[model samples]
Target: MTAEATTRAAELKQAQAALQQGRFAEGLAMARALVQDDPGDGEALYLAAVAARYLKDYEAAEDWLSKLHRAMPEYGRAWQEAGHLALARGREAEALAAFVRATRFNPALEASWREQARLLAAAGRAAEAAMARRQQERLARLPRELVAVTNHLAEGRLLRAEEICRHYLRTHPRKDANHIEGMRLLAKVGIEFGVLEEAEFLLESAVAFAPDDVQLRLDYIDALRRRQNFAKAHEEAEKLYARDPASPVFRSRLAIESMAVGDYERGLELFDAVLQQHPRDPANLTSKGHALKTTGAREAAIAAYRAAIAAKPDHGDAWYALANLKTYRFGEDELAAMKEQAARPDLSFMDRVHIAFALGKAHEDREEYAASFAAYDEGNALKRAQTRYSADAMSAELARQKAVCTRDLFEARAGSGHDAPDPIFILGLPRAGSTLLEQILASHSQIDGTLELPDILALAHRLRGRRVGENRYPDVLRELTADQLAKFGRDFIENTRIHRAGAPFFIDKMPNNFRHIGLIHLILPNAKIIDARRDPMDCCFSGFKQLFAEGQEFTYGLREMGRYYADYVALMDHWDEVLPGKVLRVRHEDVLDDLEGQTRRMLDHVGLPFEEACLDFHRTSRAVRTASSEQVRQPLNRKGQGAWKPFEPWLGELKEALGDLAPREI
Candidate 1:
């Protein structure tokens, strides 16, 4: 480190020590000096606020906290301090709101949850108070080290959290309480790091060690779901439900899992039972709306969303869910109500984000392109700030794949994997018509349609190990034995069997799988690969405007989306060169112009017979789980062909990123 940086760090530590020692005056002086050196030093500002609050200098505390809030709106500690300030001033409502905000930003804050519970009880809101108490109790049960891990994880310090978790695991006895806690914490870090396989293994081991631990089992189920091992997730969910058949929470979880695995009728029935027991539950109503929407029951889904709104007018998710249908139009009153909620200072950050996206969709439906773009931009900005995604890092990763996955590497590993050939990978950038293609293929009698399964991505992440600074994936492929590759291939098929019906082939339409084609080829050499292509402008713009439920963090910015699309194209071209004629490229526009011909081509590529049902894919009765769920449920149209024209004025970043790849016309 530089001399100045070392000195600054030492000084900050000294200031923190003074505060911990209750030397308020000395701590305040040090904090002020630090702030003077760098006004935007968030730690210094936070320390100053804490010291001033301890010294009973209310005005000074308020000033420091205001600066901290301005610099870091999502900083939960600042909001917690603000709550304390309000409480000291006897503003119970303001204190409650601040505490709620603090917990929303960082749920690991046990103090905030306790304070919220107390305030809710005082306000006579018994149900909410009980919920808050439960949350606080959950945190309180964790060991100090795990609590620290949770705090670090909440603050986006995954490496620090993992370090603490690993230390605890190494020091604690196996199968003991502390060790189980450590395992859970480490598994959480894995999930956050996108290493789902490791998380699944850890949670499964933890659950086996403590078979009766309900929370451990629940965590296992979640990990299974994240890895897209739907069968196991469903099995675990059923066990949880069987343990407490009358528990609405358990029933709700099982219902969601059922919907995930395409048991729509059973899911709807379970949701109905939950609604019967708790008629005013907005979350359950919203979930029911999702099940209905995915099953192509648009009107029923709309009614469910409206019911959720009626149960709780400020339910931002319901509003956003309706907007996400891509065809639902908000009424004037609904739009005004959404705007009011969006403008509320006390609204949760996620709620405000949902309202912003909903308003964006509302404006777009009315052809108010400027308003739509502004709202969409605001929503994307908020979501982007919370994500740890780096476009440059992603580009570097893709570049590494190209460098390592040479023809020689593939030729060396040729014919070494499982020979099942039951998987068809429709891979490309999101919003690039993969879902449309999947819908068509799924319409065929021999192919089963599934959600974007994470098996390939999870395997890739597992191979990278748990270290923070490592790129051990495509390079590690060189070290794998033929038997290991075959095992991985077999594991992928066996794990994904939960999402399959009795079809001979199933489609794995994860768009990000484009970056892992070499790994796919190495493990599942006989797999059918289809490249879903689209107009760059239309595809990137569509992705930017869509708020995906999870992943696809690259879509939050126009430049990131464009650059990712370009990277995808370059990698796919490399694959074409190295594995010639192995992957069939399906342009979305070609499908729009000639659905029958492209349908036949895709079926022929997969060695399936031509079927009239493939052309009538929209008429199929399967669950579609994507942003384009509504759009894909209808027949092909020219509606989205040039959808980016209206927002052309603000697309300079995307256009510049695309360069020669940019569409000829705006």
Candidate 2:
């Protein structure tokens, strides 16, 4: 209405247009002029900060935000923006402090609350994350839509919450703040939908609307990690790390991505440093152990595991790692000493279980079946009694998931002429040396060991309306057309190029990729499917003792691990029967029995020449990030062959399940 106000509004519009076109300097100049005229204007300060951030002038952005905060100390957005800019510059500790300050200033700021939760989750502070989520729910009034939606989320009613969020967005069309909330909810829904691409798209849009929103930034990072875009995820994490240099979270994440990208040594050092700063950090300690194992420092790795166990006696992963080292990497005397230590009465039930599992495998490897049975029997008692899952329900759910994935992968590509890539899929149960095999192959001149990828799972999700673990595929057949497969194949190749930045052949070594063998075969008939089979008991017991942060569902129980392995074997056998030479069986025992022989055969199968380095895979020195990291750093060993024997006396349940060891004819 006023002449001056109209002129200011026009200038603001022009400034916004310039900002939209990324003319940061010009837009920032306009924003400063507007703010100078009205120092109390929050919007002008916000715009100036945005422009400063765009120009990579973090100090300027902070100055603008500080002015806003000084003007209104209780201004929650100001604190939130301070956190955002801090996080953007990789200052986690400061970011955390800022976010906490924002939430303290205004608990009603749901966005700020979620940002804290997101950062906590990114930092692996699950309990803190839960607390934040609960606080968000508590602050909302009931019969309140947000309460109902969040309650549904808490109860795993993802679809209901999603529908509600979508409905809210549709009804409240013009509110940018509410719209952003709706998008955030939709992204969560997409995660539950197991649609990585959809989740990715929704979150990407959410970030576009609120580019400086810390929670949205974190959500974007998670989506990237889920899609197995480690390179990009690491890049985003680098920004976050810059925001909080002292934050252990940044180091931990960098370590994880470094490991993923085959920078094990750097990852190890970072993990070790994090553990040093936060001495009782179980995950960092475990990861550090893995790095040690990878570097062939078996004893040192074991010490780390032991220290982790000492810090947290019930630490399942530490126990598992200790056992693995004793059985696979240690000498007979060291094995005896370690087992004696594990058998101490002070050990927790989980530790005992892990020890038994490890001891059994060790005995079995020494061909002492009776001793192995004893250890397995002891471990089995605790395992069978554990109520981690209801067996019948899990069976049904797993069967349903398998059926859906099978239909999607098999029928959808039944008669299609899609020629798959090298399809060098390394499949087996986790902790069964799949990563070692990949590293060996990858070290070869022709092969690239791409990290544990989720491409097949992502592709499967897109094809069916579900994830690899969910049953949602159509019953009817609809083979992928050759052109479609070609496009998908090329996209897959291009997308995964980051993993194999400089290799001729790339490996998609998702161990669980075993479940998608049918789909893989259909897509890439010529693809070399390397069935990386360790001894059944070794694989089963190994998985049982470790702790995995992601995607080792079968590892929580002995029966579950055993049954999954059985299913995997059955499936691989079917592939052998149906596709014949399309699959090559790489027995871990044989690989150990004569490393050179196995290496030569492995190379021949993958269509590569035998390089001496393949024989000395231990000396290759690339960072390995698997349970077998330590084992691979040494020459092959016979000690792992029948390692289940010592615990055989304890394996009352699994003994029947796995009736006999398949003869070592390989």
Candidate 3:
């Protein structure tokens, strides 16, 4: 560590020691000084709250905790302190609620769980008290160091959590319980960092060591799903369900896996069974809505969303789901209720983000352009602050790809890789026309539509290795033998088989796959690629207005989106120059103007016979999982072609970023 950082750490350690030794006054003074130096320091704020609470200054303690909670909602210690303050004020119910939230945010909080059990028992709630006691007992089995690691992980101190977890794993024996827990914690950190292959490997090794460990199996299944290894994930989910057929959690997980693998009927059946036992479950209701929406069951999806809202009025996800439908309009009462809930100080950070996006959509539908932009800006600002995205870094990575994947490299590795002619890749920016293209192609008799699979991205991450400062991926491609490239292609095809029906070809419409086009070429030499293009202004603004479920952090800002789009165009142009006649570029406006002609052109490019059904893509009934799901289910129109006009006043940054690439007219 640097000298300044070492000094700060020493001071924080001294303050912590003072608090531990009951020197509340001294600790409070020290913590206050630290907070004054940096108000955003979560650890310092937590120490101040702890010291004030011990000094019997409940108001000051709460003030500190409120700031901490606002800044870091996932900090379980803040919630625990709030619970203690509530109990001191003789508000047992409020204390119970706070403790429940504390434990929910961080299951390692054994004291919160014990207090929850005590409060439940005092309230004569025997069943809840027993459950809380069981939770506390289960947590008590974990080592104190592991519990601290969990606390740090929950509070977003990932580096510290990772350091402690790795130290534990290195020091402890393999078969020890603490070692197993350390593996799970480290795997969790990997998952959060988007290193799904590493997480899958860690959990797989841990599960092999203890095959009967249920939690380890569950974590493994989750890792599999994150890796887009849906077949393996389904197998693990089935095993878990067989072990306990009556478990709602297991059943729900199995149903989600089923839905992911395109077994919609079976998924809905399992979801219904779970709802029979817990009718007011907002999460299951939302999942059910997702399944219904993807399967083109519009009315049923709306009903499910409404039911979720009825169950929990502050369910911001349900509200956001409704707004995300694009076709759905919110009533005045619903809008008012969402605003009230959004304005509450006690709402969770994620919930507030959802409400802000939902309100933005609601206002946009009402043509309140200024209000819509404000809400969108607020939501994006909140989300952007939490992300670690850097536009310059992304640009640099793209530059590396351009530098590495040269014409000579392609010539040297030409004619290698698995001879898989059954894959079609539809890739581009997120708000581009990829989904519409997928829908059109899926209407063909020989094509199967799949979700945005992450196999290529995961492979890129794996090749990059665990370390940061090394550029191992595109450079590593040069060292791979022909057999290795073929094996990778074969593995990708085998892994994605679970999402495919009995079709001759399948579409992988992952937008981010555009970044790995060279990787795709090296792996699947015979695969077809379609570059889905849209008008730059419409595409960037549409992405700016929308809130994606994950990734696409660039869309949080207009300049970022525009610059990213410009880089994308530049890289794609380079690809065309190096890999000519390989990618078919389809324009969104041309497709809308001449649906049949464009459809026929696309089919011909893929070496398929022209089919009339491609023109009637809206009538095709299948799972559509994208922001444009509802829009694609309807006939083509120019309604969305110039959507950026209404918000043109605030799009100068986007236009300036696009430079010469910006559209001349709306």
Candidate 4:
């Protein structure tokens, strides 16, 4: 670490020790000084809140908590402090709500659970109190270190969690010949870190070490799913189902995995099997809706979503699912009901976020542009707070790609690595029309469509040595021998073969792969790449209004989204400069104007014949798993082309971020 960083760390440590020593005033001053020097320092903000709260400076404590929330909204300890502050001021009801929020953010917060139990009991809600006590008791059984690890994981302090979990595993080696919980916790950290292979291995070993441990098997299945190993996930889920034929969890897992593998009929059957036993299961109902939607059963999907909402009136996922259809128009009653649910302080954190996005779509559909923007902004704000994604860091990373992967490096490594041209990488920013391009290409008989495959990203992660975020990626590409590159390319093909049919060519539409063009070219030199480009405003605003299942944290804010788009464009330009004619640029607007022409261009680039089916792509029957599925199912139109115009009033930050790249009209 730098001298300045080392000093700051020591000061923060001293402040922490002061708090432990009951020197609240000294700790508060020290933390406030740190905060003044680095306003975004999450640790300093949290310590300041804790110290201020203990000192009974309620207003200052509130100020620190609010800043901490901006820095780390999902920080359980911060919310716990907020609960304490409210209680100190005799606001018992608010304290109860804050405690509930704390537990939701980090279930390992035993104090929050204890307080919740006491408050619920005082309110004479015996059943709720009993549930809280059970939760607290369950947490009490875990090792204190593990609880701390869980808290760090939940609060997105991933590196800290990984450090603690790894130490625990090292110190407790051979204690159980399995150490299931420690391994499982480490795997959870791996999943959070996007180190899926390590996570999958850990969970897989844990499951084998204790086959009857249902939680381990379920986590193993989740790791498999995250790796896009749908077939393997289904197999694991089936084992759980075998253990208990009547368990809803197993049935639902099997159903979801089955759908992932395109066994929609079997998936739907399994879903129905569970729903019949418990008709009001909102999660199952929502999953069924997703399955139906993927299979082009639009009306049936709508019904399933509506059923989920009816079963659980406050289920924001169900509400968002309906809005995500893009074509679904919300009715008056549905909007009011959603507003009521969103207004509830007792609502879950994610539920509130989901409802905000759903409300955005509802208002947008009604042409209430200002209200639409406000709701979308609300949801994005919540997400931005949670993720704490840094656009500057992202830009720096992409810049490293440009600096390391120069033309000379490509020339030196020319004619090496795998020679197979079987893969077609349709890559760019998310919401940049990559899905539509994939649909067009996959309509051809020779091309197979796949989900946004994680194989490339996983391979990149594998190359990033032990220490991540130290700029080891594209630089490491220089050290990889030709044989190593070829082997990696071969492994990629073999591992991803599960997602492919008999087609000779397949699409891997992972948008983030644009940052790794150098890595892709080094491994699979003959692979074809298609750059899906869209107008900045349309793309950024579309992304802002949508709620993705995971990742794409940049889309949570207009400025972040715009900056990311600019970085993507710069990176793509670098790729073009270094590897001319390697990537085919297909603009979304160009496609809308001349679908057949652009389709022919992409086909020609990939050495495929211009089939008429590519023109009738919307009519082609295939499972599309993207936000654009509904839009892509029908004919291409200008309906979505200028969507940002209505919300232009609130998009100044986006335009400012885009600068010269922002279109004149926008």
> Quick one: best TM-score, which candidate?
3
Model 1: residues with Cα > 4 Å off, grouped in runs: 1-74, 93-110, 113-143, 311-314, 466-468
Q: How much lDDT does candidate 4 score?
A: 0.89
- Per-residue alpha-carbon lDDT of candidate 2 for residues 6-37, written as tens digits (9 for 90 to 100): 99889888888989998989999999999989
lDDT of 1 at 117: 95
Runs of candidate 3 exceeding 4 Å displacement: 1-39, 466-470, 664-666
lDDT of 2 at 332: 88
Candidate 1 lDDT tens digits, 126-176: 999999999999889878888899789877889899999898888878956
* Superposition error at 30 for model 4 (Å): 17
- For 297-321, candidate 3 gives per-residue lDDT tens digits of 9999999999999998888889999
lDDT of candidate 4 at residue 393, scale 0 to 100: 88
Q: Could you estimate the TM-score for every candidate?
A: 0.90, 0.62, 0.95, 0.84
Displacement of residue 431 (Cα, Å) in model 2 is 3.8
Residue-level lDDT for 280 in candidate 4: 88
Model with the higher lDDT, candidate 2 or 4? 4
Off by over 4 Å in 2: 1-143, 147-171, 174-176, 185-195, 241-259, 262-423, 466-477, 658-666
| TM-score, structure 1 vs. true | 0.90
lDDT of 4 by residue, 1-666 (tens): 899999999999999999999999999999999999999898999999899889988899998888887656667888888898998999989999899989988999999999999999999999999999998997898877788888888877799998988888888775654357889999999887777888998898888788887778889999999988888999988888988989988899999999998888999999999999999899999999999999999999999999999998988899999999999999999999999997764466688899999999999999998888889999999889778589998999899999999999999999778888899999998888998999999999999998899888878877776443434787888898999999998988888888888899999999999999999999899899999999888899889988999999999989999899989999999999999999999999999888888999999999999999998889989999998899889888888888998787788999999988987862
lDDT of 4 at 204: 85
Give lDDT: candidate 4, residue 236.
87
